[model samples]
Target: MAPGLLDRSRTVAPPGWSRWLIPPAALSVHLSIGQAYAWSVFKPALESSLNLSGTASALPFQLGMVMLGLSAAFGGTLVERNGPRWAMTVSLLCFCSGFLLASLGAAVEQYWLVVFGYGFVGGIGLGIGYISPVSTLIKWFPDRPGMATGIAIMGFGGGALIASPWSAQMLESFGSDSGGVATAFLVHGLVYAVFMSLGVLLVRVPAEGWQPPGGKRPQEQQSRKPLVTTANVSARSAVRTPQFWLLWVVLCMNVTAGIGILEKAAPMIGDFFADTSTPVSAAAAAGFVALLSLANMGGRFLWSSTSDVIGRKNMYRCYLGVGGLMYLGIVLLGDSSKPLFIVCAMVIISFYGGGFATVPAYLKDLFGTYEVGAIHGRLLTAWSTAGVLGPLIVNWIADSQEAAGRSGAGLYGLALSIMIGLLAVGFVANELIRPVNPKHHLPEPASAAGQAEGTAGHEGGAEHKEATGR
Candidate 1:
């Protein structure tokens, strides 16, 4: 697509445009970036071909995650100012080029190049691509923001499910050697570059005065529930609010607890059952991982959509409250029964995925849709923090406990106990949340401000313009 053709004003949806198409645009971006989760499929190949240690081979993924969060945090305002089309275009270039660069790095036996390509370049793609469609989706589906985000974010969870086996098959057929890995990387870059362009082309911002079919104006809706404040908070202002930090803690703790288990899932299963009557084989462990992926994908859609009906805060209460209990179950009954262990792990992962999908809408609820993409981008710092912290806590504890003669569920007890405490703290933070103070809301426009001061009759109509982004 031509760069000039994608001007933000030119990309606004027509009056009758269907919002259903928006989710697919979002999926095209998310599904591609979500391949970050499938980096493990390349780990053994990188290690074997380059003769690198496990820690050395992991640098690309770790650095990529850190860059994902940092780039998103820094680039968020640019994305909002330039609009989704611009963001999607930049994401496509960086993401695809990273893969191509990584392919070259592999072919030349330069591991640092691979790290730079995928970690730094591709990680920027992951961050920008992840947030590109969020504000657009929220604007299009004002009445069902949670469900809209669920559809898009669910693609991120499912991306690994699609990529892992597909990449494995490609590696198997081409060969697991460095040359073969390069070929796989080259193919991935080319294919994803083409795939992600669909988002760049299809995405649209809502035109002025656009609303869902027969939907009421923002003022009318807010009048029905005074709690749903109709006010904008800039990203700068948002970060200063107590609500933002509370949410940061909520997301960080929830993600930390879930990711710890997910990071060590396949091996954790093996160890937990190693001395039991039913030992989990490598194949069974793979199946367990697949089940967790399914639960993750399902929860992104199911639990997030449910949040639309039940309210974002209430749904998170279920996530932390019930999720904490599920972890307790795993810690207590994990060694006794395989079925119980599997069930508890599945539910916990579901909540983990659900938390990611629902948070954007939660931001919409608390901060308003103005600059939500940027706010959401800033909030992802929590994920990066948890990404490092969660794995460190779990892996370090498990390793130290094993060295000290602990085995099975005992290795995880300390981690799970810590997770429960984090959840309790998050629950309290959620309870502390209240509506944003009026002083923090965006100043009313001069005309709107004048009308409100001059006449009570004009106040509703004036406020409606500001609230609806008209």
Candidate 2:
């Protein structure tokens, strides 16, 4: 009945309680980044059509990941200052451009173009897009940061589910040859641009006094430092802390352990059964990839939520310590049974996914949520480091083994052993984590004051319940 009510509703979130929309906005961006996981689908096509080696063809995906971490770390402060809309908008433009540019590279048979487009440009998008909604969501859903993050992150893990099948079909329809790969990349770029735009436009931050329903804390309540409070610990101060470097080591080790399998999933499976009675088929190997994706997605939610209960430090203990045991089982067993190998690999990969999902929450808990987005952006440097390290370790070990005429589980024994060692290192790093110091606290601003009361109250209740409750 109101003349402008319909148009007004569409323009912005209704004044009181529209922060609920932030999660969907986050999903839109994450779904697109999720496509990053599907890069393997293109690898075979690149190898076959361009006559490229697995390592050469992997450059774009690898570089893209590097860029993702680098850009996120380098540009975190900008995202914080500019707000999610601006950050997300850049992500849309760069990500789309990366795809479009890669399409051109594929069409012309210029590999570096794909490298520059997808790796550099699109990687930047991935980084910015990844962190854009993080602080915003944590702010909006202070009580259930884990769940809110899981809602969007689950889409990221699932993004590849949609992308892998869709891309494979596109490759099939487009003929899997060079031109088809070009078409696929082009379409993917354009389509994701459209998909991510919905997030940029629809996302809204909480107003000055807004709080999560039933989750508000009162002012004047003492609160522990948030791990993600960037204002207090600038990138300079953050890196200076023992905790930051320790986390870096922990994340890098965890990521490297997982990626050792991810980079060589197909060949690894194939190698495992190269001498078996019923060896892995091409289809079976592809199935393994899909299974890994499922584990990755499941782990993101499961492990992160587990951290909410078990505490971040202890949860990582399982990731690195028990994770080492899993790898040991895989190494000792030697793919003796496909089922055991698959189960072990899946569990390890899930922990990898969980590590990723939990890190943001870890940052939120340690640094405070004020500038969590920026702090997380900076911490992504660990991701960049692991991206390169993980693949390099796997591929290098595999390559070395191949050169030395090793195959199957024999080639990976060395790699898995290395992962076990690295995870042990991460365990030490996890142990080194401690509460952030008071020197990192930023003075509260007047604008933040309105929300501070409830924020502190909720935190106080949690601390009391956590520290002293029966």
- Pick by TM-score: which candidate is best? 1
lDDT of 2 by residue, 241-344 (tens): 77777888898899989988888898889989899898999999989988998899899888877776566778899999988999998899958988999999
In model 1, the worst 10-residue window by lDDT is: 450-459
lDDT of 1 by residue, 1-470 (tens): 65486566567676777888899999999999999999989999999999989998888888888888987899987787677888999999999999999999999999999999998999999999999898888888888888899999999998887888889999998898999999999999999999999999988876665666775454216345433666767687899999999999999988998898899999988888999889999999999999999999999999999987778889999999999999999889888889999999999999999999999999988887767888999999999888878889999989899899998878889988988988888888878888888777766552233222212212343355458574
Q: Residue 392 in model 2: shift from native, Å?
A: 2.7
Top candidate, metric lDDT? 1
Q: After superposition, how far is residue 124 of candidate 2 from its true place, in Å?
A: 1.8
Evaluated at residue 111, the lDDT of candidate 2 is 85
Q: Given candidate 1, what's the lDDT at residue 107?
A: 98
User: Candidate 2 at residue 199, lDDT?
Assistant: 90
Q: Could you tell me the lDDT of residue 267 within candidate 1? A: 91
Poorly placed runs, candidate 1 (over 4 Å)? 1-3, 216-227, 446-470
